[model samples]
Target: MSDTLEILLTNDDGIDSVGIRAIHDALVEHANANVTVVAPASDQSACGRSISHGGEIGLVDHELGYAVEGTPADCVVAGLAELGPDPDLVVAGCNRGANLGEYVLGRSGTISAAVEAAFFDVPAIATSMYVPVDETPLREIDLSTDDFREARRVTTYLAEYALDAGVFDHAAYLNVNVPTPGKRPAPIEITRPSKRYEMDAEATDGSVTLHDRVWESMDPETIPDPDGTDRRAVAEGRISISPLTAPHSTNHHETLTELAETYHDRVATADD
Candidate 1:
């Protein structure tokens, strides 16, 4: 990678999202980075690494960049394989909502975009901002650029440093969560995903409501994760960076190995 980074940017929250725009602006102004954005034309949150598989996908040209009528992962695939130049790095998000914890790793479209890039042997980073749920009626939350300043700064800093410092040599990608900007810039913490999970389901009148209790435990005082976990750090109003690998890992199991080796014998016995 050259000193001037070639970055392919994407996000779950469409190409027009404020968060993605903030990140694009920051990278251009602060790092002098060359960026090409190809993102979902519409919100694809929680879509994970889903692609359009043989279906037709449309790409629309926009002021910020290309808008892909597909999932976040599809944007990465299109950006890397068809739309733009080969990128030195893939940066996804500055997502509207935080994506933390181990359980969300495979389900979050923001992180899944980064994971998709990693599979192509490219270094990637995924970022998000935590938005607290309000009791008020659901309305379009208008976020000013200030709301994304911290995430932009962190994304710029990481994009420059991680490429220069060879941090990708150790990990496939990074999952970053930043708290809402406060009176001062928050501290950065290197963390792991929290293992805690909370879910509740209820059925009434033949319909069902599923609730994710993880949000309820997001308060710093109530979070169950240890201090060094992403959930804990985010709850404590810190920027959390979790280095992660894209592949699912497996360990050798003696019993499984034995079962495989004796498969023929078992089959013969069954026949008898």
Candidate 2:
């Protein structure tokens, strides 16, 4: 716990992206916390912690600071282990889109970066903005960069209050999403990741089309998610913050263990 916040900033969107720049700017406004950005030189969305094998990682001098040539997780790994002092907190986004629901999380590089940090016993946050379809350009979304004021609002507030207040003590990391303000009736709710998405993938003549059905694209009137779920809260135009823990083991049943032991002993004795 340094006296001041030392932050390691990163994103799935490449270092030159607008979203990362906006976030870095907002964090720099804090006179106390120092922000150092070490992120992928190129966009690695949905790559999900996949590291390059012996690839070149060099310093990229940006207007903000140095950017690395690797995945989002690579940036965090390099920053903590090599580049800067271990950050007080790792913030992974202000991503181009919401990373709500279990399915989305498993596929999102932004969330994966935060998850990687949690493995090191460091608290992290993954933030995103919801942009309705057709409103954004295919080029930029392809480039994977955007900054909504509401997304920044939630991220700034969380960054300021979350650490010192010990909110992260309970959760390994937070996954936050700001609903597009265009959606009517905004309300913020503490929520859980919804695990409701089905994949419809098909292969055509030398091509593949993977359709991702996100409920955020649907009208709030049609979503079947219960209250307090991350998807539901965002659909309602609220900033959704989900407290998440990475990779945990469930307790094994004593009776089952005992039975397994007994069976194993009998089999061993019989073999002897």
The best candidate in terms of lDDT: 1
Candidate 1's displacement at residue 56, Å, is 1.7
Best by TM-score: 1
Residue-level lDDT tens digits of model 2 in 108-130: 88998998898888899898877
Candidate 2, residue 80: Cα displacement in angstroms equals: 0.6
lDDT of 1 by residue, 1-272 (tens): 67788899999988888999999999999987999999999999899888898878998898988999999989998999988888989999989888999989989999999999998999999999988876732126788777899999899999989877989999999999999898888999999999988978999998999988888657787677898999899889999999999777899899999889999998999999
CA lDDT, candidate 1, residue 62: 89
Q: What is the TM-score (0 to 1) of candidate 1?
A: 0.96
lDDT of 2 at 126: 91
| Model 2: colliding residue pairs | none
- For each candidate, give its TM-score against the true structure: 0.96, 0.86
Model 2 gets an lDDT of: 0.79
- Quality of model 1 by C-alpha lDDT: 0.90
